[model samples]
Each structure stands twice: as structure tokens, then as C-alpha cells.
Target: MEIGNKEDNRGYWDIVWNPPGERTGIFDVIKGTEFRIIYHDESQAEVSFTRTWDPSLEGKAVPLNIDKRFIILRGSSGFYTYGIYEHKEGWPDFGLEETRVAFKLRKDKFHYMALADNRQRIMPMPDDRLPPRGQQLAYPEAVLLVDPINPDLRGEVDDKYQYSCEDQYNNVHGWVSFDPPIGFWQITPSDESRTGGPLKQNLTSHVGPTMLAMFLSAHYAGGDLSPKFTDGEYWKKVHGPVFMYLNSSWDGSDPTMLWEDAKVQMMIEKESWPYVFALSEDFQKTEQRGCVSGRLLVRDRYIDDQDLYASGAYVGLALPGEAGSWQRECKGYQFWCRADVDGSFYIRNIVTGNYNLYAWVPGFIGDYKLDATLTIASGDDIYLGDLVYEPPRDGPTIWEIGVPDRSAAEFYVPDPNPNYVNRLYIDHPDRFRQYGLWERYAELYPDGDLVYTIDQSDYSTDWFYAQVNRRTDQNTYQPTTWQIKFNLDSVSPNSTYKFRVALASSTLAELQVLSKERKKDLAFSYLHPSFFLSNVITGNSSCMINVLAQVFFNDQDKGVPHFTTGLIGRDNAIARHGIHGLYWLFNIDVGSAWLVQGLNTIYLKQARSTSPFQGLMYDYLRLEGPCGC
Candidate 1:
């Protein structure tokens, strides 16, 4: 089938048919009849073609062998184009035709029309013709082109819509509207887009795929992949010699060889100093002491020996490793042989402390002496110096000495027993009399356990105990006396015992009266005596008065008892025959005591009398031993 113009200059066409394969026998029978043409055009052109023939020469009015030709005028230019499309066998030969013409050439101006004879056959359509509005064209099933880089855009026109290169160029050129603004389209010198060129260099040297892959890995892993940069060592480790130049001359007047030799000597002396003498004093007396015993080997003999030693030298030493400050007991010292000699010596001791070492030889006005403060630990040998001693024109002799002071002693008091009573006697004879009485009573009944019978005979005023005067007027009641006794029978022999004694006025009214009179006394101003007893006994004995009573009374209250005048006594004792007046007694059998084998307590009591208004009534105490009756 042919659909478009064939040598038809008007750009119009018709369909004429010739079947693909020829038929024979009965099916090939006959065709020959009037035929008509049909066509369409974009410009509304009109045209037509027809034929009429008789087929009797083959005994059929429409003979199968009959063929015909017809013309379809297409345009006013008379240049109408048509197509011959064959639909069936010998259809063209049967005088059938179809034509098309541009609408510009037709008087009716209809853009599309159709014509045909009684036959039902229609003309074939050209593939290039535009479809009706909103109508889709049928496309081929197969794909033809493939692009690897942008495979999504590759295919036959039928399989995918063709994207116009013009549109792509316009979008890239910033001429057409795009949802996202177009970026710069970098071009090469040749005026072509540079999409295929290498991408811009990464400022951080992160450009290539490998670098990108590494970066992605680091980001995902959350750490750097490269090794960290570092400076290996932090602290410097120093060792070897420490060369200290003392009076060394800066000018070349002192040979370099001499200085170098001296430095080496200093190192040798530092090392050998400890072996010779452990202390500086040992080195100062002898040449074989400390490092001085080592030979002095001079490297520069040509240099003046006097100049080498006298040119304001420096002292130095070699250490095994880094050395800390010297410690206690150890010291460093140095001595030079002579001011003009080329040799000097150093002494290092394991002992530490401040030290001074000196060499005092005749004819040498300058004594080589060095004083060093050092604290050396055990096993430490410190180098002191290659001291250079210059001779003074004249001055006092420099002597080295070591003087150490003695350490103080440590003393502490041990615990004391609380049961033994201590007493002191002051200046008055009356006070001594009373105190001696108490003492005698304790000696007789030393076990501190004693009992007393208080009756008319015991109440005599003669031989009563009294105390002397004290300093203050307020407490000027004669001598201050205390009578304390303990029950030793209740206490074990050689065992410690404690007791406490307290004195209080028998009545508040009496205490007030006494306090009024003794308020100005020195004894009254001080704390009242509270006696404690601590003692160990040796044998069975009864309660005994172990403490003496003394008085410190002022001149104004001369011969008066320093304590308040009142009846003093311990509870739980035998009743005493006396006026309803105040009475004083010490009971030994009442309180607790610790007794051991062969030790017993003696019971005893001594009495004395005093009155706030009357002053001292008695001046003596009567002491009695344990009853053997």
C-alpha cells in the first residue's frame, strides 16, 4: 500500500492498494468497475479521481485482468499530488483511485471529505497525518535506543516521548522558566557546555571519589581515620657533668686547654671524693682526704700554672643522674692546694648538715676553706666545689668549725593516785600544831580506818587545834587546816585507792555569818579545799587521819580558822555527846574500801573548834592510835 505523494509536487497524497501476495484459481475471478477517491488536507484542498470500464472481453463485466488509470486534480496550480494504495489484488488494475488535495485549491474549502463507489473499500491513511484533538496515536511496541549515562531518557520515539534538545538547551541557558532557578552553565573555550569536564578542585583537597568515600566513612564512623600528629618526648632527661666556673678569666689569657683539663679534674674529684673521706673534716686535715688524694693531671702544661689556678676559677662536678638538693647531715666542701697551684680538691660526704672544710698551710696567706649547707640522705655522695681561694693581702685568719647543739629531752607525768592526801603548812606555829596533830593521828592509825568516841571527856577546850592567820582580811580566820582519813582495812595491801573529802557549814545561817566575816580574806577569795586521797597500804590497819591541816590566815583575823565556822561531820556514825551546838567528826566505817589479805582499816577522828564571831577557840588537835583494848 502506498499512502504519500510519489512524484506529487503538491505535498498531498491518496491511498491505492495492491495486495501483498497474488491469488490464483477461483478466488482471482473478476474486478472492473467504477471507483472513487477520498482524502483530507490541513489547508482544506479538494480533489477527485474516477474510472469506468467494461469487462466483457473476459466473459465477465468486471474482469480480473482489467487495469485502469485516473487523475485527481489537487491544487489550482494544477500540481495536485496523489498516492496509489493497494488494498486488494488487482484493485489498481481494476480502475479504482483515491486522491487528496490542499484545501487552498478547493472551491468548497472543506479540509476533510470522503468519496467511494458502491464498493465498501476505504482509502489507506498516511502515518504522518495529525490526529484529532485530544486523540492519542498508537505507537510501536519495541524500544530501540539505550543510553547508559542517562538511561531514563533512552528509547524509541514510540516507547517514550522525545525530549527536545531545544528545550534542554533553553532550560540550561536560563532562557526558560524552571521551578528551580538555573545555575551557571559553564562552557569550554569551544562554546560547548562543560558538564563532561572534571568537577572543580576541592579547596580542602577532598575532590575525588576516593576522598569522598573516605570522608563518608569517617562521618559514619564518627572519628578521624588518619593518624594523629604528635611531638614524642615531653621532658628532657639530663645527666653527666655540671661544670661551674668560678673565677675563670673570660679573656684568652687563660688557655682553653687548662679550662678543659680543670673541668675534667672537677668531674674526677666528684666521683672519687666519697671514697677518700665520708666527711669534710676528715679531708681538711690531710692531703689524702676526699678527692684530693687523686693525682692532678694537667692537660695544658704550657699554660702558666699560677694563672690557671688564680684566674678566678669555677667549681663543678659530675653527677650520676639528676640530683636533688642536699639533705640533712651530708655536706659539700672544697679546698685548693695553693693559690698559685693548678690543683684544687672537693670533698663529698654521705653525712648531711652544714659544714666548713679548710686547708691551712704556712706561707699560703689564703686558706682554702669552703662552707656548705647540705642535707644528704643515706647512700648519697654530693660534690661540693673546686673552690679557688684567693690570697688576701692581709686579714683575720679564716677558721672552719663544726658546732652542733644537743637535742632537748622529753618528759611527761604519769597518772597519780586519788586516795592519798597531800598537805602543806604555812607560817604559824598554831597552824603547825594542828597539822602535826593530824599527821600523828595518821601515823598511829596509818591504815586510814579509825573510830572515835565523842563524850564529855573528849570535849575539852585544852589542846584544841587552831590555824594561823592568812593574808586577806575576808578569810583571816586563823590557820587553814584539813583532817582527812581513809579506811585502809577495806583497801587491799599494795592496791591503789581514791577518796574525796568535802567541808560544808552545818547550817546555812552559820555559813552566812562566817562568810560575812571572811569575805575579805585571801583564802576566802580562792576555791575552798576539796581533798582527794590516793595511796597504797602495806598491812592490816584501821582508818587513820593521813592529812595534816594548816591555816593561812591574815593579820586582821589572826589565829582564826580560814574556813567557815560550822559543825563538820560525815553521816552514818555513832552519836556524839555534845550541846545542840555544831559538832565536827570524820566517819571511817561508812564509805566503801578495797581490802586484801592481812590489811585492815583503823577508825579515827580529830576535832578542833572555831567561831566566826569569837575567832579561834582552840590551837591544838588530839590524835589517838587504834585501840588494842
Candidate 2:
């Protein structure tokens, strides 16, 4: 093993090893030595041990200098750097319900130590209070990171932090700050000095050695998570019309099209825009549409890659195994582009061959060019030269354009004369004394001006506007609660306003955003209190439940929900786009309370049991307030 010299706050890095004696009978620490961070190069995944570089022991394991280490890691800074690790011959003694799942990533993990602060997230030390990871920790395992000042940081960084220390068995116990801070990082892990010993074994004597130590650490998801069958047409005929050209400009005016010029304008309006859609075996209708282009020459700029302006960043385009990761950005096998402003990119069409480009620019880390590999043939142009990268030294001068331009800069700025209009608009029969500011959701509440639709609504195909409930005792998932009561006469009602509750949740539990004047959970705000205990899953093919369209209101409208890579599938479960399904996290303002002129009730607590195969649902909810919403 060799890796030496990188410290000086580049997140510590030095592996170099040579200890391996004992061959006559097999016992040099059971034939293993340890130093984890794997994905396959040896399989058996879990192995985050320690050998302590003795930064006095930045992470612990000093008795006899176990392997002499130095691994701090921040993670997938941009499509993994030095990934696929696994040196084991051994390393897994400590307590054991679970240990290295985070930083070791794979749940679509992307770095920031597996997505910022919580680093590779997975605290779960359970009632023992703490001491599952490598041992020795009585206090000090809370250390947050990433406030090197907060310039936006995606996933929204800026964690509150405590500076990582970990001892009484949570293990890490030294040298904090390895880049943390990302939305209040807090791993309390308090309470588990269990005298720093006991646990010797349990889970039924490690059930046959923890199922042979999780099949020698390869992790088998038999608990069910289905979605590894692939072949959508063989992945649209090998990543069809192959796209992915970050930093645009080979010609094709940046609309960020490596693939998906709006799914090729809906396959050119489903076959007809001058034809040309062959994904192989000829789905016929050809006229040619195969493009690809590039250019990301970052000359040499470091203050952390010019503080990660890293030239328009994010430019993936994989295809050839493992392409369904990180929440689902790898859906259908990778294809992300956006490196314009000079990084240059293009993709008129695709379906070529051989690819792996990768690029990312948050704190400037991996793949500016660390193995981009490419090749195209079909309709022309394949220039993928120029990918020079070299950014990392205490990174983060401040970056983050991610999350779709910070949610299109929130309304991309343009409120006009807005202070909140559209005061009241009713449909359906939501009961609110003659309310009808002019039917919008198509009509449902208390039937005021009539627009009807719930006599047994079933509308499908989704545009994110469900009202569908096929009532098999409900849960064919459609309608749960949709209402609007009034009394403040439209405006001026005790001031204080911030209602942005969109909607969704075909019953997982507790989603109250009540708003009465005197009683009824008084002006409450609850939402997801056991969404089926973190949504149960058990797939062999038929164990689906993935909800992420939040907006349960009541935190004073700092409003957050934004997800929209578009998803809400259901021909009968299992077929997603940006990751699993049910996507559409609308702008959640969902109201915050204060309207009190007369009668006001905005309650929505109904769903408890419904199971259209349990597809947890919700629909187009853009409720704004002020005049008559």
C-alpha cells in the first residue's frame, strides 16, 4: 500500500504499509490488516479501522501501532477520488450492530465526507449511548464541521458543529475539522461509556458470525430494496444517443444537454419531429441524432480551484455498470452536463459507445480529469481532450450552484406587486361557507361554484396534481385531506403569515398543520411521525414505499421543500427517474399561523390506513396566501 504525504489540512492522507508477518499457520491479525473505504477491488466492503498516524492518534488505535494510519476523508468531492478501496485481510472486532456504512458510502453517497458534516451519516449507537465504532470514547463524538464560513454549500451546508473528538468507544477521538458543517451537524451520541467494554457479543452470538460477517462484508440487501434489474430497452440502447457534456460549447447552445433535450422533446412529440430516434434494433423513425462534445481545461487556479467556481462544474456521463446511485442522479445510467461559462460542452444526440467523463465542482475535488474515458461514433464530433484538474488544499473558498441554482434563486427574483395575492379559490367540497375565488385545483371543497371531480376520481399519468383516491378504503393513494376554511375577510387578520403547505402522504402518520383560533391542536405543525417507521421496504419485487414531497408547514415559513427532477410513477410501483419515485418537493410555505378574523380551520389529518400497494402520495399544491387563497 502506498499513498504518503498530503497533510497540511488536505484532510489528512497517508497510507503506506508493510506489516504482514505470520505465514506458517495463518494469524497475522487473522490474515487481515485493515484500512477501509471500499466499493469493490476486493469486495467485503465494511472495514473502517485505524492505525493512527499519531497526530497523537487523530482517530485512535495506538497500542502497538496497529497499522500506522492517517485517513480523514471528506468524500465524493465529485464522483469519488481513489474510490473502490478494501485492504482487509481483517478488521472488525469492536461492538457490532453496525459500524462503517457512512464514509464507506454507496447509498448514492457523493462526498462532503458522504455529503457533509454528518459525514457518512449513520449514528445509530442505540441505547448504549455510544461506543460502536472502534471503541474508546466517553464524551467528544459530536464535532460538526464546514463553517469555514458558509457560502451556500449544497444539501445546504453550515452545520452548527462541535469539532469532532469521539472517545468512549465512538472512536475517532482526535484532530477534528476534516471539513464538516452542513445544516446544523450534531451527532449527540451521548451516553455510552458503558464503562467502555461490555458488548462482548449479542444479536444472538453474532448470528453465525453476523451472517458470516455480512457475507464477508459485501452487504446483501435481502431486506428488500428492489430496483436493480435495469434494461429499459437495455438502458435505452446503451445510454441512447449518449449525452453528457459539462461546461458546454462545442456547438449546441447550453441548455445542459448531454441527453434529455426534454427527453428529446418527448421523443420529438413521441415520434414525429422530423423523425430520428433509433436506440437500436431500430425503433425505426431515423434521421440521425447522435452528438457529444467537451472541453474543461482549468489551466491552473487554486484557492481551491478558484474557490470552486471550478468553471461551471458538474459534468458526469457514465454508462457501463454502477449507474444508479446518489439518490438517483445515476438513473438510467448517468448523464449530467453543465460546465459552460467556458468549460464547454454539447450533445446534440447520443447512443454512441464507451464513456465515463465525470466532473464536479463544489469544493473542487475529483474528476476534472482522473479517468474520463470516452469514444463516440454514429453521427460525428467526439473531442473529449482537455480535463486538467488540481484543486484541493483547504478547499471551499465558497461554492455551490447545485440544487438547481439554489432553487432558481427562489422564484428567480420577480414578485412584481406581490405581497401575497390569490386570496381564495375553491373547488371540490372542502366546506368553508361559499368559498370560490375561482376554481384552481379544479374544484373539490364544500362544492361552492362547482367544478366537481371526487365522485370517484382516478385521473392518472401524473402532472403532480392528484385528487385520485380509488377508494379501496382509500390508499389506492389519491386523496387524504385537502381543504381551506376562512374568516379574516381576505386580508388583515391578526398579521403574521407564512403558509406554504403543498401536500402528499397517503398515510404514514401524523401530518397535522392545524390552524384553528382557540382549540384543535391550536395552530399546530406536525408531519411525518413514523412515516411507516421510516417507510418499510422488503422487495423481491413488490415492497414499494418512497415518499419525498414534503410541505407539512408550521416552522414559520422559512420554507424548504424543492425536489423536482420529476417523479411520481405508478403503473403499479417501481420505475423512477431522479431516484426511486414520487418526486415533487414543492416550495413549502404551507402557512405558519396568525389569521384570526372569525372562523378559521385548516386541518388535514385523515390517512391512517390505505395501501394502493403503499405508494405514499400527494399532489400539485401551490397554495399561496393574502387575498382569498
Candidate 3:
């Protein structure tokens, strides 16, 4: 279907897909079966297109029905579109790897793409990615524009994945046409129907003069995020009602102003969520939705005796499962809100259902899950009084490193190699997204691993962002050990200590605790020095297994790890140039006998060394002395 002002060829945009080659099958195509008008009035109009699955074509086509809808209100500057995907109870089993709605703009007209204020730039033409002009890099998605129509982009890298952003900030992004001074924007009002949580990264606008409304994708989070149906299970979901907005300079203003205008329009759409104009019963109206409100307070006695307001806390309700299930939940809707300065939050327009309230406050180490399930009915305004979150803490803090904000952005990120730079992030805040930073770890520490002293070292400068493998030779990598040194004036032999660590991201990696009594000999505690665990959570479903990290004291093997993060996560945040993938917390108990009065050290080793990408990023680490010590 055509969109935008048809009279002006520059504004014309269409939904297009590549025709399947000879090897393509019927299931690959979204064949439209029927189209009909749902309603028509002076105020608004709605239409639906249904693609029903045929039993006769079961072996060849996907066993499902797909319904797509579009709506436009009078005097509106944009239109809304949504879709429904369903599979019958007796349908054949299949897996949905990826699904998204894409729009191809007029290539000649839209030359500049804007993802964020600092991320917007004139993009390379589609032809620039061709052989003679471009040279392929590690993957086909990445290419070096060796020779481009515009000499400025020459010697720069062009990768669509480089422009990915978290779902929280992916509100409005599109292309700006300079000739006629027009903009084509895609605006997502809410993420309730999305798969991963707020931090999940997905693609946005890229070259080819393209814009996308991502619904389900395996871009950052791998196979776990892909939904698979087995035994003909009945399933259905509403993808979106995202807005396609168009704007132009009315008084001969700069075309770039359209981006700011689109941002303002985005807020307007967000405020009008649960749009009342949709005719489908499946799309709930404002009256059919509910609101949840409460105040969140945190009590970490080590920080203060009185409860502190959990300001800027991320509070949300999702399908009840576990304390941190919200990040991996893909089947249902989620409603999230940020707590205000006084720790107050008001989550509105949530679809009626049973949910568990989940929250994580900045500067805290663990997640908080409400004890009771909340049930919301139509027009229900539920108020849960004061809720308190006591973060995981066992004693007074001896020392701590880094922040507990579920991100490794606070750590030191090295500059990218000059030969392989993106140029856009040379001095940008997101310098962590640069390509080939993993190899820098080996270069910075050619002879030994990282060593940090409690009072003398600064985490911002001394601590590396990720614990990557050290390249021994060409095509070979080996695990590395980092040391943390601390001192105590006196030690209580009968007390127990708490060693807490939080990881912001992990990928096919395992953490092992080793002890070194004299700094000369390597000693093992629980597992024998020759013992090894074969598999890890690789994020690839076909080849996944449980992985673990251990802890030790004074280079003494404590029989078993005080704690082990068995089979944690597979978010490949390191290679993606992201600060975090998934959040994980572990609290270990250390025997006081392992501590000496003067000098003590703890060694943390990442056991996985097969690939440069196998590593983990620490969010925060702390060692707490026993209470009343």
C-alpha cells in the first residue's frame, strides 16, 4: 500500500520485500487472502487485511493466519498500523526466528538518516555497498566504503547493526529528505508488546534508505529470544499499533527541524496510548485498561538506618514468573514506569491481567519481586502503599568497585584501532560500540593480567570494561586472571565475610576462583587443577549448556565455590559494542580464617578461552565484613 503524499513523488514510500529465489518455499511469503474495511466515518477510518492458512497447503505454507490493520484519524499528521499473528491448536509446529515491519523510502530523496541527535549523518547510497565501491569486512552486514559517491564517507565502515539501540530509547527514528524538506519517521508509543526488557537492543534506520519497526528480532539477544512452537500449541499476539509520521518545513525552515518536530509528535502519540479508535476487540480501550501506583523505598542499613527513596528506579509489571523474568519474557505484555524523585510511580493503561511487580533500583545489587500477585480489572486504580526493597547485603562494606546500575559503561573502554574506526564515535559517549576493542585487552597487558589495589587504584581508569581472552598467537587465545588486593588492620577469626559480585553481561564464559598463597604457585580449591567443565550458555540453542563462576579466599581452595552462577546468560554485549546484555548477581560467603591481618588477595579467572568474544563484564563488586565487626 502507498503512504505519504502521493502527488509528491519525493514523499511516496512503500512496503517492499525481496522476492524469494528458486530455493525459497511457500512458507517464506506472507500471502494476502482477503481485505475489507472495518469502519469508515468522518472522524476516522480503519481497514484490515487477513492472510489465512490453508490446510491443503500445510506442508508448503506456514500453518497460521496473519491479520494486519491500518487506521487514520481526521486532521492527523500520521497513520497507525498493527498486526496480529496466530496459529491454530492443531497447526503444524514451527519456529519464528525473526519478524519486523520495514519501509523503503525514496533513495534519491532521503539521503540523511537520524537515529539520535549525535548519531545522525548523511548515509552511503545502496550502490556504495556494491563490490567496486565497498569491500566486505568480518561479515556481509559490515562493509568498508572504500570509494563512495561522496568522498567524505570513503574509508569509513557501514554496518546496519552499528546503529542498533535499546528498546527504551527507540521511540522515533527515520530519514530526512533535504530537496523538498520532508521527513519520514517511525514512532513506537509503547514497548508492552516487545519481547525483551527495556535494555534489549534492536535495529533502527539504516542505509538503503530504510526505516524499521522492530517487533521480534534476534539481533543482540540470540536464540533464547526467538519463539518456538511445538505440538501445535495455540498462540496469538498483537505486534503493534506504531505510528508512521510525516512532516515538512512549512515556513522554509531547515529540513533538520523535522526531527525535532517528530520528537514532539512522538510524545503526543505516547500520551494517547491505548488508542480508542481501534475497532478490534483484541485491542483494549482506555476504559478497559487499569492503572497501578505506589511508592518504592530502599533499606540498605549499610548505607543508612532510615529507608531511602528509590528514586529513578525502574518499576514494572509483567507475566509473573521469577524475580528477574521480565527481561526474558516474550509471551505477554509488560507495563513499566520510572519512579519519580520521591520514589513515587504511576503505571497507567496496562492491559487487565495477573502480574508480578518487579523493580531494580540504581546503586542496588539485586532485583525486587512483590510477594503477592496483582490482579487488575477494567478501570481499576490499584494503590499499593509503601513498598520497601532491601538490597542484598550481609555486613558493612570493606570496599567496593564500580556501580550497580546493570551497565559496564562506568568502566574504562579503550579507543578503537585507528585503521578500523567508525569515525562517528571517535569522541562520542558511546565509544564502547567501536569495532575490535576486544583485541586491545591483549595489547594493554602484554605480559600480565589486570591488578587493582583497593585504596590506590581507580576503577574508572584501572578497571577494564570487559574480561576478554588474551591472544597467545595467531588464531589462538588463552584465559587470563585478574587480582584484587586489599589490606586489613586486624582480623576476626570467628566471623564470616560476604563477597558480592554483579555481572552486566556474559557470553559463553565461565568465572573461576583461584588461590595464590605466595604469588608464585597456582593452587586449586574445589575442582582439581586438571578438572574442566565442557559446556556453557552460548546463547545458541543448538549448543548450550550450564556455565559457572567460582570464588576463593587468600589463594586457598575453599572445597567448593562459595557461590556459582551456573548457566547464566548469553547476551553478546561485548562484540555488539554494548555496555550490558543481561543482569546477574551473586553473593558468596568467605571464611574469616582465610584472611590475614596484613596483605590478602583474591584472583578471578575467566575459564573460557576458545574465542576472543567469550568474556564477561562486571557491573559491580564488593567485599563486606561481618556485621558489628
Q: Top lDDT: which candidate number?
A: 3
Error of 2 at 390 (Å): 39
Q: Model 3 — TM-score against the truth?
A: 0.88
Q: Name the lDDT of candidate 1.
A: 0.21
Give the candidate number with the greatest TM-score: 3
Q: For residues 170-247, could you state the per-residue lDDT of candidate 2 as single tens digits?
A: 221111111221111112121111111111110110100000000000011110111221121122111112111112
**Model 1 per-residue lDDT tens digits across residues 144-260:** 222212233232121111111111111111010021211111110110111100110000100000000000011100111111112321111101111111123234442223323
What are the RMSDs of all candidates, in order?
60.3, 24.0, 6.5
Candidate 1 worst ten-residue window by lDDT: 205-214
Q: What TM-score would every model get versus the actual structure? A: 0.12, 0.23, 0.88
The clash tally of candidate 2 reads 75
For model 2, the superposed segments whose C-alpha errors exceed 4 Å read 1-226, 229-333, 339-480, 484-606, 609-629
lDDT by residue for model 3 over 29-57, one digit each (tens)? 35457999999999899998888887886
Off by over 4 Å in 3: 1-29, 54-59, 515-568
TM-score head-to-head 1 vs 2, winner: 2
Each model's lDDT comes to 0.21, 0.25, 0.78
